[model samples]
Target: MKIGLYFGSFNPIHIGHLVIANHLAEYSDLDQIWFVVTPHNPFKKKNSLLDNYQRLEMVYLATKDYAKLKPSDIEFNLPQPNYTVNTLAYLQDKHPDHEFALIMGEDNLKSFHKWKNYQVILENHHIYVYPRITKNIEASQFDGHEKIHAIDAPIMELSSTFIRKAIKARKNVEPMLPKNVWEYLDEMNFYR
Candidate 1:
């Protein structure tokens, strides 16, 4: 099976994430899209993140209704300060029968070169890039690269940060997230 790994903290799984994943799963060559919830991202601040299981639960709630989308806690058991290259390697070893690709935003493409062992990653896996509203341009080296495929998915500007802040400020941000995810967050009183 061809799976596209959509890696993120998913601090709280929101509609923006579902839109992109659903678009990729339905429109791209990928058969399924896995939400690889990272326990710790080297580039992101750990302080702002919720517990790994809590974040995973939100992802489960958000993606449960979609057959093509599935939540994965693959990184939770992996070592801390998770890096993309390492996780990719681990997945490749464990799921040798499956062909794994990457799902990322155009904003992340701008910094693709900075990732550890980026050359090795590009050589082994394909990257499906979705549109993002970012000022920085993608690296020239990635332009027209065979390994990187630019998908014409919808541009989602909504962010988990915005949702979290809205909830904390006592504002209604229900429309921003999946209904079950919003209910889960509200029930748990998270981000407040």
Candidate 2:
């Protein structure tokens, strides 16, 4: 099966995430979109995130209704400060029968060249990029790249940071998240 790996911290899964994954699952060639919950993102501060299990549970709750979308903890057991290239290689070795691709936003694509061993990733796997509202355009190096595909997925401006801030401020962000996720957050009093 062709699986698109959508990696994220997912401090809390939200509707914007669901939309993008669902869009790619329905519109793209991918058989499934796995939400690879990163235990710790190198670009983010670990202190700001919830427990890894908590975040993964939220992901499971948010994606339960969708068959094509599934939550993954593939990076949880990997070494801290893990890079995408290593994960790709590991996944390939472990699941030789399945093909894995990447799902990222256009903003991420702008800095794709800076990732560790990005050329190796490009050579082996395809990347599906969704449009993001960013001021700077993508780098010219990616133009006409056969391995990269620009998907006409919805541009979601919603972010987990905004949701966290709102929840801490005691604002009603129920609509931004899935019902199960919202209930779990409310019950746990998370982000407050």
Candidate 3:
């Protein structure tokens, strides 16, 4: 099986995320896209994040109906400030029968060179990059590597940060998030 790892904080899995995952599953060669909920991202602020379990639950609610899209809690057990290289290595080791790839946005690719062991990641796994607003990835920078693929998936300007801010302002978030996820957030009074 070819699995694409879509890692994120998923602070509250929003419609934009679901849209991206759906497009990837429908249009790409990936057999499955696992939404790896990171417990903590070294590049992001820790205090603003919701608890890992809550974030994981939101992902579960958002992806419940999609068989090809799975919510993963693998990073919850991993060490804090999880590095993508380490997580990918561990997953590859544990699931040798399954081929793994990394799914990311064009914005992340801009900073790809700064990531720990980026060269190993590029050599060992394929990177499926989707477009993001205001971030353009230069293909030439990668020297036309066959492993680096640009996917023609739908790009949404929406982000988890926007959703959190909206919720805090008591703004309607139904249009931005899955119904179940919105309901869960309202029920838990999260991000208020």
Please write out the lDDT profile of model 2 over residues 80-155, one tens digit for every residue.
Answer: 8899999999999999999999999988888899999999999999999999888766365797899999999989
Sort the predicted structures by lDDT, highest score first. 2, 1, 3
Which stretches in model 1 have alpha-carbon errors above 4 Å?
136-139
- Clash list (residue pairs), candidate 3: none
C-alpha RMSD values across all candidates: 1.1, 0.9, 1.4
Write model 1 residue lDDT over 33-82, tens digit each, in one string. Answer: 99999988887789999998999999999998889999999988888877
A best-first ranking of the candidates according to their TM-score comes to 2, 1, 3
Window of ten residues with lowest summed lDDT in model 3: 135-144
Q: Write down the TM-score for model 1.
A: 0.97
Error (Å) of candidate 2 at residue 76 is 0.7
lDDT of 3 by residue, 89-145 (tens): 999999999999999888888789999999999989999988887735355476467
Which model scores highest in lDDT?
2
What are the Cα lDDT values of the candidates?
0.93, 0.95, 0.90
For candidate 1, list the clashing residue pairs, or say none: none
